[model samples]
Target chain A: MHNASTASTTEAATVPETTSSVDSYFADHPTPPFLDNYKDRIQDLLDFHASSPRPIVLITSGGTTVPLETQTVRFIDNFSAGTRGATSAEHFIAQGYVVIFLHRRFSLLPYSRHYSHSTHCFLDFMRPSEDGKNIQVVDEYRPEMLQVLTRYREAQSKRRLLLLDFVTVSEYLHCLRASALLLAPLGPRVMYYLAAAVSDFFIPTKEMAQHKIQSGDGSLSLTMTQVPKFLSILVHSWATSSYIVSFKLETDPKMLLPKAQQALARYGHQVVVANLLHTRKERVVLISPVASTEYTSNPQYSSHTIDLAPGTEEIEEPLVEELVHRHEDWQSTSSS
Target chain B: MHNASTASTTEAATVPETTSSVDSYFADHPTPPFLDNYKDRIQDLLDFHASSPRPIVLITSGGTTVPLETQTVRFIDNFSAGTRGATSAEHFIAQGYVVIFLHRRFSLLPYSRHYSHSTHCFLDFMRPSEDGKNIQVVDEYRPEMLQVLTRYREAQSKRRLLLLDFVTVSEYLHCLRASALLLAPLGPRVMYYLAAAVSDFFIPTKEMAQHKIQSGDGSLSLTMTQVPKFLSILVHSWATSSYIVSFKLETDPKMLLPKAQQALARYGHQVVVANLLHTRKERVVLISPVASTEYTSNPQYSSHTIDLAPGTEEIEEPLVEELVHRHEDWQSTSSS
Candidate 1:
């Protein structure tokens, strides 16, 4: 099944005008161990989609690690907890979309996000029974726990969600490519939600220390090469018919809109969701080819932005709703 | 209560011959938000110790993060899951020591480590009732869960364990200093187990980028200054009467013994536990002023190293037992 797509990708491996091609990048770096199971997982997804014709969304979450050593005692890490991706996946599942959640190991998950990332310890949510023979969810939290559990169990029974995970940038890239190619047959019915905060720079595999770097030196100087831009390849070749929506997270407000616009222009993806580091939870700007609009949790922005009640739901609830609407429109247009 | 110690620390803040002192380092870096509560936590510890009169051990666990930017979209992270520190804390608590666990945020805790860091999902350990009305721990894991829960509750009820956390290197340093100074009144009754994998290099506050670094520049060149060695200050002034055990982790076999010896000689700490990155779980070397010895999970090294049958207990079990014996010897000799 992979032979034809692999051949086309290999043949399409021209030197990109700015940086190395995705094919060359894969060649230079060793594939992750989990890649061995990728074929089986993709086959399962394909087989499931054939039997069920719901729109499938591949949601990448959390932050990728860039190992400083081959043995890996130290690494460069991006700041992400996988909150966005996990929450978005739950929403997608509610919208009747099948979700393939590709997340960072130990990060939050779709159903588990609520309790997993809470400030309270897992044990804190449970209490000993009156007889002290068994433990159960605390009285106050039982209702909510049951609701989440029911949804999670329902999704599992229906096989609507698939959980896949990665740790390093290399693993994420390899998994992304393989998954994209596997889902290409679904065409515009598939949506790629790239929410993971992937590392921008990495020490090449060959250059990385075999062991932990010695700390005796007074100062540490590191030179890292930029990770080659793969979004262009992802859009143009791997999943050409899929609706691609990439994220742009910046600390500076000035850089947010500009960078998001540039990514849209360069990759020709359907949408670029721009966000600031501080206000990302409360606000986001969706930049499409024709128009850009803001979304906020603040009720004051109701006229211009998709204003959601402050505590009623998360910013992602509205954001994903808008995204699903746009994706439906794209599918109709493409089919026509 | 803190005035006398603050005055003494300020007077003792002479520029060190090799590296900057802890006082100067704190002066250079801004204090973390939790500093206000540090005193209260310390007072609580002191009051508890005064009533119980048990030996107190401050276990510093997990890896400290070094932020690349002030807002911190990316950071340099040391590879540690806090297994050593968390495991050791449980052992210490079992040995009747009051444990103050100062760990990195989101890292493992002593009693919680087993269920929390397991590869299986938290929900996997739980099952819905036959009637589908409630969730309970799966039958297979019930014995272990009950044992852990009983111990956790016992510790909480007795106030024998205090949990504190930090995220950044700066916060870790400040917290360490404050806690040590507060514990100094106990003199030889206290022990400092420094197990945290602290960053060797960090971007100073003034030099760090205010916003997320622009990735358009293709390549990234980062020059990080050496994190001022504060062990000298820790040994010379802060909690001087306390028996200090520091960790020296290296990937290179040749560097491990030498580095461990150097740290012992330079800081004059009671013990320096040396371990290779890969073999840390299975084996470790205890280097003290008088002698150096190995501790291993492998029974093959039983002749030279302290060896226990695998699966009987963690390597830390024997390691902590030996340390407690040594610490008892130290207390008697010093008093004499």
Candidate 2:
């Protein structure tokens, strides 16, 4: 909506599936999209997605690394499983949608000559498990991942394992802001599953010890600042016209709805998910605050309330089935 | 559950909260429980959190720095609003649970200490408006967070902006592996929101990046190795006794269930959240995979079958709520 140019009207007519990323495949010249200056390619892709009806799914995972002074000062590394993004991507790939699985930090996904993933996983001479179970588990990798690797082995592609890591919050912010641009093309119907533990603030290096954490010293002080909310950026800028969904994982007092409401209000996402801390089981809640307050009375065994709006052609039924029938019987105003 | 001590009793009972950290938090002290060394004056707060019924909420809010080599590293970061942890903590606090809202990267939150966040109406950040009617909405923040920050500020609590940025895959992994111990005592209600963008794979230091971007080679290489699925650790280890929830963000693929199933299988979490990317609206599917193949079929809707088991006595209801209904349902259930 905030484009510098109208772009070619034909872009709406172009649904280039199996297309290239910001950088198209050159076969011989495998360059990152940023280098190829494939802005048009992405711009075209954005227009294409905007003009299309297909739902867009963007997957962002892993940590970001930055270039700093003093031998490249790095901070804030994490122990992420990469499972959130990897498995999610596989799911997206299977769900009949074009997936831009952007992985960060230590991911085990295969690379293509077209995409150079910074290798984030590594081997540690980890201390043997208290009982040795860790060794047993860590000794072997996952099967699905292994299969993906094998597929890559036979696939005719060359990949460089780009192991990009970041310690400073700024570096992660930069990478997130830039790479997040990838999601621009896919307008609306955008659902973001925010499953990452993002930092809220960064401390000053002078207060933090190079090694050793001081307990209750307050001496190790940090000047805290708010990081840019990527979800907000997407809604307010990148995909401002697009529908966005985000997450809120919490615990302690366990206030789910208030947080959900806050999320909906602060980030402009249509839905906000709030889950309790240590909720290893399936008790996560999906709050659709935008739904009419009337949902409180819309009784159905349905665990959630789905708001069906007019105009948009909804398939035979909502994607999620109603656990219980709604009390209201409506005449079908034929829009389809 | 293999144990270093063949004595499962000892291993289970005395499970060190953080013995396996590759990046030791107490490296300076070199003691297992550093709290004990300080003349026992520290009150064993960390231990209390481990045993606290309130369940420990460990939030990692900063980005990680990835290293190019052992000595040189780049600061890779993402743009994120620490809102996820900060606000979520407010919700949890209002829910009447003790929360350990750990943060990094950003520094400030707007609220008074001890404020009951749920007592106020929060602003709707997710909605869009052309006339800026929505923009006029008063921004809402939870009160508990305000209260805590106020206390911390007034107490002059010895604090540091704890931003955990990682620049290399290994560094991220190291930090991640280290912090996992924190969850040991708190056990199962652990909800790891992988909202961070970690690099999927990286270029192996060896024979990769020879033609750096500065040279305009525009070519980078990597021997991408999959990062270990740390999320699975939650499943295999404690969730064997606790619960795990994960999130999946999608783009282009509207069909979101299968990927959720894949996440369930791989991570063994009770719930796998699937959402679309780049939309202003929030849309996600909460999938709870029934571990058992035999499901009770009503033939009306796709049934969500779950194997119910209790992790701890105090968690029975919380566990059930996570297993089936929403968190609000739990409140209703508990109150009713």
- Best prediction by lDDT: 1
Clashing pairs in 1: none
lDDT of 1 by residue, A126-180 (tens): 7667777777788798877878887888888888888899999989999998898
lDDT of each: 0.79, 0.36
- All candidates' chain B TM-scores are 0.89, 0.53
Which stretches in model 2 have alpha-carbon errors above 4 Å? A1-336, B1-44, B48-52, B60-65, B68-82, B100-104, B107-172, B188-195, B203-213, B216-218, B238-240, B279-281, B291-336
lDDT of 1 by residue, B1-336 (tens): 111122223322333324344556677788888787876987876786696668999999999999999999999999888999999998999999999999988788887788775556677677677887788788888878877777887887888889898888999999988898899888778888999999988887788899998888988988888887777677767777888889999988988887887675555557788888878877888876542221111111111145555676788998899889978887776567
Least accurate stretch of 10 residues (summed lDDT) in model 2 chain A? A323-332
Give the per-residue lDDT digits (tens) of candidate 2, residues B72-187: 31223333333334444434344434433333322112122122122121211111124422211112422333334343333223221122333344544444444455455444
Q: In terms of docking quality, how is candidate 1 classified?
A: medium
